[model samples]
Target: MTLHQQTTRRQFLQGTAAATAGLLVPFASRSFAFQSPNERPVFATIGLRNQGWGITNKSFKFADFAAFADVDANVLGENLEKAAQRQGKKPDGYKDYRKILDRDDIDAVMIATPDHWHTKIAVEAMLAGKDVYCEKPLTLTIDEGKLIEETVDKTGRVFQVGTMQRTESGQRFLQAVALIKNGRIGKVKKVTCGINGMQASPVIPEVKTPEGLDYDFWLGPAPKVAYRALPEMREGYGGGVPLYSNCHYSFRNWHEYSGGKLTDWGAHHVDIACWAIGASDTGPSRVTPLDYTLPVEYKEGYPVVDDQYNAATQFNIQVDMPNDIEMIITSEGDNGILFEGTEGRFFVNRGKITGKPVEDLESNPLPGGAIEEVYGGPVSENHTANFIDAMNSRKQPISDVWSHNRMLEICHLSNIAMRLGRAVNWDPAKREIVGDSQANTFLSREYRKGFEIDM
Candidate 1:
């Protein structure tokens, strides 16, 4: 199976049709050369340490794994070896993702870097005429979310945010949403969102940078900080004290990288909450962060994780949307949604949707066609498969940048409100914070010189 040079559009469309029709469409086959039908949809991956590996591996048969990038040389070497074994050829490796975008041969990129790098790399990739599959929490800031949406429109590049939940049947999640949409809950009144507490990253002394790792590049747009090897000392979540690193996933604590449990997990649940309630197109008009009882001796600063994470360890954020529906997005209890309506109350998470409305789950009472419209319709194909389909279809994947960017902004707003400990008013149509200079400032961060996410 050599590269089918000069294949017609008709052939590509036919192949896509077959694949969509449930046939085994080969994305890449060993019999095919590096130039086969599979290779026609070229793809590269950056940040191939953990999630990147799985995302890249799934693209194995359908795309040519032509290039890989990571700031950590160790991660780069590992990914390169695995990609070579899978593709039957070595791929170009680099530390800077912008260089990967510079390659004319590559048509798409999978970005599995930390939450911070997603926006900058994706904007650049689109500008360079490459489609992008970026990880969730799509932007580090609400402003970056808007910038990404603008860039996607400007570049006309297909982008899929790694919100694979859209692809999942998420039976319980869908069921809960369906229950609300079908009126089983009787004019949904409020959503009580309970997320698990974020653990703190206790202070750890700085350590020498690991060999072959470009620590600076890993920091990327983040301000220059001394390197620390202890897991708690690292930036981003998942670890020690509640504020030093915020909770687990420390970056979620810092304004620069993530929105702690709020955006980290909220992106998923809130997205579901909005979907279930038929409110995805519009978000809450107001976001107020509930105060927390922090331990004494708290110090505040940008990249607050610098000394220790300071993102909300446990707080409730109320987002008031249209229709008197108040979304209580929080980390106040067990992680999930509790829907309290005029008629009944129900809760749902990855595990279950329980309460008086269990009958709705039993009967599937949601509106039949409503789910598709809210979740962007059938474009929500299998995550990896959708990427390949977009490659050949030349169409936006279901979880495209503009759609998810809205969600990202909402998530960011919740964090900003919580961080500032104030109510932040949003003009969703205008996508701006209303008359609050300080709140607006939280919408974007000051990037390290030479590392700003470009327009």
Candidate 2:
């Protein structure tokens, strides 16, 4: 396969300027090459809620919106109009995402569905001969990650998880990785990832499904349950729906659909931590839940209550990573990562990268192309740009499935350990729980009838 030429440092800086100006320089333009509008890839987005619309919105620069799909008609229609306004043309809309997959015109599908729906849609999209760019926390379980990885290998499709920190976020994360690899931090000893906790909701009541929203379809592979909500609308970020409900933005709080903060913010911070420490392709040997608090009671690793949030409320997990590294994932402290090494320590997050090593950059800076070297080549203008470039080159993007799943396994194990109230030993090579048949059952969930993946 022929690879696209890596972007030069000057070109990357220029592309960054274009991104800041709200105009993405086309991938071809970065190489002093031009692509006509018709040459852009065709894309259709599934699950057009908060993050569904977000990834699609950024992708408008590299791909044309051919259609949009969502279980909520209101969300579908809203994003359709938004896409038309931004792209100067209205794409089609559908309640069934499968309809988008059936279309031959769409070269790729951007999946921003809830965690439960990610594997099904992504696997089907790949089998249907379409590339995929799915959101982070890519799987709800370890088994789902394995299935997705297998499907990607079988189809040879380009799959990019929406972990934008690897490409964007002011390149602070990239700089952090480069600093670590350059011996600025010496041999890494301990890394703490501070992914904040979720608030336990006061008993949400089972309520009538809203108009134009297909509640059943939203539930999908998860167990059938009454739509629960309180008559209060959430305000910012992923607002508009009931803030305490088991649907929409609050879906992350339910174990049936997502894995709370362990997978929510853990997907971002843990992914970066693993990459910086050269542990992306491996896994932790033991996941010990030093301390944790689940919002509801559980029996046999299953939540007892159905009306309230069931995922972990706060947690402090210690994972024994490769190379005798100590990794502490906790809900306490500021929301960021702290890398402590033999020589020095540094803290980094989306907002800033600080400490002695970062301060030393003024006198002794990272070598030219350091960030690109850490990124495996020139970084694209944005994550979506990297996806598009991969589509053209037939290469996997920065946040590939193999690495994403490896790091995500730690988050998944942390949740499992907390749910079972015991540390779970893992065999990374076998990808299974050791000596705990009962605990191993959580690796894969049984899908609800008629919603199972039809591989």
Q: In lDDT terms, which candidate is top?
A: 2
User: Which digits, one per residue and each the tens of the lDDT, describe model 2 over residues 1-455?
Assistant: 21211221011222322222211121112221234455667889999888889888887866789899999999998999999999999999999999998887788899999999999999999998888999988999999999999999999989999999998887788888988999998999999999998788899888899999999999999999899999988998888788789888899999999999999999999999999999999999999999999888899898888989999999899999999999999999999999999999999998878898988887788776676678777667778888877777778999999999999999999999999999999999999999999999999999999998978
The TM-score between candidate 1 and the true structure equals: 0.82
Who wins the TM-score comparison? 2
Please provide TM-scores, in order, for all candidate models, with all chains considered together: 0.82, 0.94
Worst 10 residues of 2 by lDDT: 2-11
Question: lDDT score of model 2?
Answer: 0.87
Error of 1 at 306 (Å): 3.0
Q: What is the lDDT of residue 375 in candidate 2?
A: 79
Per-residue alpha-carbon lDDT of candidate 1 for residues 154-187, written as tens digits (9 for 90 to 100): 8777788887766553445645655676777788
Q: Cα lDDT of model 1 overall? A: 0.67
CA lDDT, every prediction?
0.67, 0.87
